[model samples]
Target: MRIIVYGTLRRKQGNSHWMTNGQWLGDHLIDGYELFSLGHYPGVVEGTGQVYCEVYRIDASTLGELDALRSKGGEYKRQLLQTPYGSAWLYVYQRSVAGRQRIESGDWLKRDAVSE
Candidate 1:
């Protein structure tokens, strides 16, 4: 399965190890979504903005591991969205974002640029 990752799962990030067996299909910008700083990591939810993401082709076993990491039924919900790599799974934030800092820049890596 293909997946779009925008936060810790991105290249060189803390949690990217989870994608060790996946292939990087390049980066892409996805619209109609908003990124928020969920502390050390980030979360994306469907909204009015866009987000920078890395597309990957992962196997079923990898998908299962990712689902568990994202807390598939709790903190996030996996949904299929269009990407340059074709339809891919995106982890949409499911909890209230109230009081959280919005990564206005959309790109999680460049999130610091927003306030700089």
Candidate 2:
């Protein structure tokens, strides 16, 4: 299976260590979604814009760990999205993004370059 990560799980980010077991497949833009700043991390929801993400080929164990970390059924939900690498899992935010700062640039790595 594969997963699309846009925030801390990306290369050189804080939580990237968790992706050590996965294969790096490069970054890509996913349409029909939006990225937002959730304090130290980020949350992506189905919307009208696009998000920058890194696609990775992962194993079952890594997927399980990621699910636990994302709070699968609570804060985020795993959804199958069509990527350049074919169908992959994307963690969609479940809670309301009211008042949350949106990362208009859609790229978490370059998030600091743009302001809401």
List lDDT for all candidates, in order. 0.92, 0.92
User: Tens-digit lDDT track for model 2 on 3-116?
Assistant: 999999999999999899999987889999999999999999989999999999999999999999998569999999888888899999999999999999999888889464
Cα lDDT of model 1 by residue, 1-116, tens digit: 89999999888898999889999998999999999999998989889999999999999999999988897569999999988789999999999999999999899999788374
**Per model, how many backbone clashes are there?**
0, 0
TM-score (all chains, Cα) for each model: 0.94, 0.94
> In angstroms, how far off is 72's CA in candidate 2?
5.6
lDDT of 2: 0.92
RMSD values, in order shown: 1.3, 1.6
Worst lDDT window (10 residues) for model 2?
Answer: 107-116
Best by lDDT: 2
Residue pairs with clashing backbones, model 2? none
